[model samples]
Target: MTETVEIARGPYRAQLLALGATLRRLEVPDREGRVANVVLGCRDLDDYRRVARYYGATVGRYANRIGGARFMLDGREYRLPANDGPNNLHSGAPGFDQRDWALEDADASSARFGLTSPDGENGFPGTLRVEALYRMEEDGLAITLSAQTDAPTVLNLTNHAYFNLGGEASGRTILDHVLRIAGSHITPVDADLIPTGALRPVANSPFDFRTPKPVGRDIAQDDTQLVRGLGYDHNWAIDAPGRAATLYDPESGRVLDLHSTKPGLQLYSGNHLADGPPGTSGGTYAARAGLCLEPQLFPDSPNRPEFPSARLDPGERYEHRLAFRFRTAGSVDEAFG
Candidate 1:
């Protein structure tokens, strides 16, 4: 395995690897001027390859779930690998997360990684070309993803980074992290965690994050959605793509402002993160050890006509922009200000 590439600017520093175009480390400072590694992962690249967990990697051909591991495209049915029950999760096993990307360019402030997927690979049509750009600005990290395919194919790409703002790998969880999402609706999943093809309102449910609230505030409610997700694994329908969500850690005084152009944000509470390898921060992680806020198109969008389309044509190019604005402040307003 090759060495990881690191980029630094101001108080923000990040480590990137060509393997899956993954982010090996992301360090940010708090109000006391003390820095902590917020992103969770092992120190070795082999651990990532063997573990197969998305971690801080760039996940694609399709980022989330696809119902029945199948989709009908242009009157043809395509069957994908059933890696997640009867559904396809993160493009199935040995998907993008397990592949090594080629380094197109690298510098102190940014680096670009690229991958080319052949037709019929992973049971998806088209030869897909994808690029991921990781840039370190003065206050945040920006990732711009672009893709093109030789044939019409479904694609939804996103970074699967698990975050722990409270600054510990063991007993410290994300329960106290105050989070606010600009979503008024969500694409609820079923027993298999596949979207039910409905964009239901979040007005009176534990899924509401329009206003700031603790992550564990309603996670244990008797709601069926909560029970189905195990925590907050469902995708929240985001309207203002400019302002997708905002998360703050009272203990560390660290704030992360999420900005994306995607239609949905998957807020996973790391319910199934148990029995994982020891983290770089030094602990055997358990459930709720971290939280993931993945911004992308809705899961199972290929089969859901009502949701935004994820199809890319021969002459068309797909582009997505995501930014995690980080700062040390008392509240969300100060972080943005």
Candidate 2:
């Protein structure tokens, strides 16, 4: 049975749908606690039907990329749809991001969704069953994913939520926000944005975020990676003893810290955003107006032997957890002062 959980904070309201165990919307207070729905999402069920690009949604069955829409398993080559150029992106033609999920359970603070994929779905070789959990805590939100397969299969999952701390329709870009990534290297991508299977040091490159820096500081640098992706859309290799990457908006004293066990985090500055569609904030989205921090295995991990394996087999369960904790930097009186 499908269910919905309502989480409210003042005039802002969020609905967590048990279907697919997704955090469908998160309407929250901005810098002024003025109540803004910052996350990119659809206004209603019909809007989701018309939009294909998964906004504020859960993505799975391989969340990143697979080279040539094909991979060899046990000496057998499996061909996927090759949706992105010469490579397979986000799990071929009909990825899980757009599928309707079964609701397993739900409560005031949490929800769970489940789905079973028949063997050979999307050219993958396995009967896979996956479940995702969405939890709303006092701090922020926590997403937990688990999956198992009757046969060996690759899996990677992530939530694609676009955030704008200044409030979604505030008409300000994310240029002024400060970001700090706890990493020393990054997985360098090829001309087509596929990982070259090599982890390069972020020491001198613009990818370095050892210390707090503005995302736009060196985004326009004449670097190959930046030029290829149009901005910061590649994954950063997190340092060992992994913890969380942080983003702070001084204007609102709002901070979002992301913690995950995943090896890589893709920082997308929303360079492809356009004003073609109406957003949840009741305003047209402009480029660079928001950002996405997706934690997961490296792109094309099935093809990269050195990267962490994304394979799930019978009796072996795949699990990962991510937390997005929100906090205020100052006291209420001081913040208002």
Candidate 3:
């Protein structure tokens, strides 16, 4: 059985599920004060089970991909189940996203879901305990993912929630949404979508989002990286740790400011978000219907020595905080000014 938890503050609200500790729904008021669900989600638990797209789900013991479905940790090579072609995605098949988390605690304004992955689970070598806390604060929603392990392990967790500021079921694409990422370099990927271990400059490429631009502006450019991922599916090695990215929908006047503690941000333009599963708008979610600003560690970080370490040892804790602030363009201007 799946349990639902609702949290709201002011004009912002969110609904969470026990399964995958998923964020099933998020409603916020637009410029005209009309509240609508802005995140893509299935109509029911059965639908969620059918759609493995990871909509609003909390992903992984190691989010993103692990090259060759294997990594060397403390000199021991551990192999994981290859789910995404030749790489391991979101830590294999039945990862944290597929597990049922326990509702450890909840209140009117906050909820905490916990999950424990036994040692050797998904080929990871640790008895990891994770907690996802969703708190409705001020004008935004804060999500803190923290974990501890009894043994040394590599962990990279993040929420895989797609956003469409115009509202999820509006039958609209996010191509027109304006976006800004706080990184000057992106970890370019190979044909297999795994990082190439090189921090390529975002300048002179369609991947640049430094000054804020429409997501579709140069998306159709004849760039090799664009052809590789099919769209913006690579990770940006963020400039700093604070605010990572910003997204705004002109039509709705809704703005989303993403602040994170992580070192990397992935700008996924919903390149493959098509087919199957009816959305909240009672229609099939089309390609590019939503986009994900996933704040996480660089993909394939376990194998990249130059990247920040994702290793967690006994008595140590791994914590990642992502704050999504929602407001209207007018309000944003006032706040900034």
Candidate 4:
């Protein structure tokens, strides 16, 4: 049987699932004190299994892509299952996101889920032990993903939670949401959506989110990058320390600020959400139904020699700290301060 846990503090609440340690639901109050779920979710665990979009799942043993489903580590080339075109995405099918995690602990304001990946699982080295911890704060939620490997391997973990500040069932796309990312450069990708190994400046390009603007403003442009990813599906090289990005829904006055310890942030515009499973609110989601702000190492970091390393050796611990603080536009200082 599947298990779920709910944690709350003040006006904030979150529902977590044991399957993939998924974030099933998140509730926070709007400007007028109206509370609602803000993250996209499936109607049930069965739907999550059939959908395969990674919705709200904890993705790993490597978070993003591995070029050609292979990477060289310590004089050995490890091969992985290629699921995303000619590349490996989210560490291939049956990835950490598709596993059943054990509910290790839970309380009124926090829950911890654990899982163990056998060596060679998904063609990844190391018998990895992992944990996904969700803690509810007065303002929003904090997710910490940590893992340890018994052998030399590559690891990058992150939560794939898509956000729609206006509410998940608001019957609207995130095109109107104003977004601001702290990075001035992005890891450009090729036609197959794998990083080209170059940190290209976002200046005067549709990829530039350094200044706040509507998500739909330049999304329809004929820019090559936009055409390749079908929208914004690239990783930004984070230049800030504290908060990495801010997403705001003007209509509802809801504001979400992202904080992360990772050097890269993947801004996926939910281009393929239309093909996802039926939503918890009852209906198939449309494109751009929500947007994902995934904090992790750059895509294909395992193959890029100059990228921030994703290598983990025996006795070494890997950790990714991600926090999402929600509040109304009028309470930015009160919520973050």
User: For each candidate, what TM-score against the reference?
Assistant: 0.97, 0.91, 0.97, 0.97
- Candidate 2 wrongly placed segments (more than 4 Å): 1-5, 8-13, 17-21, 30-33, 330-337
TM match of model 2 to true structure: 0.91
Off by over 4 Å in 4: 330-337
Model 1 per-residue lDDT tens digits across residues 99-198: 8899899889899999999999889999999999999998889999999999999999999999988765436888888899899999888898898988
Pitting candidate 2 against candidate 3, the one with the higher lDDT is: 3
- Misplaced by over 4 Å in model 1 are 168-171, 331-337
Query: What TM-score would candidate 3 get against the native?
Result: 0.97
Clash number for every model? 0, 1, 0, 0
Q: Write the per-residue lDDT of candidate 3 for residues 34-111, one digit (tens) a residue.
A: 999999988767776666788898999999999999999989999999989999999976888888899999998999
Candidate 1 Cα deviation (angstroms), residue 218? 0.7
Count backbone clashes in candidate 3.
0
RMSD of each: 1.5, 3.3, 1.5, 1.9
- lDDT of candidate 4 over 39-90, digit per residue (tens): 9999867987766788899999888888999999889989999898889999
lDDT tens readout by residue for model 2, 1-337: 3355775433445676544345666765545665555566655555555555556667768887787778887788988887889888778646776666787786667677788878988898899888878777776777788888999888888887777776677788887777888888889898888999988999988999877788889999999999999999888888853455888776777777788988889888989887546776567778988888888888988888789888788999888898777765653333223
The 10-residue segment of model 2 with minimum total lDDT is: 328-337
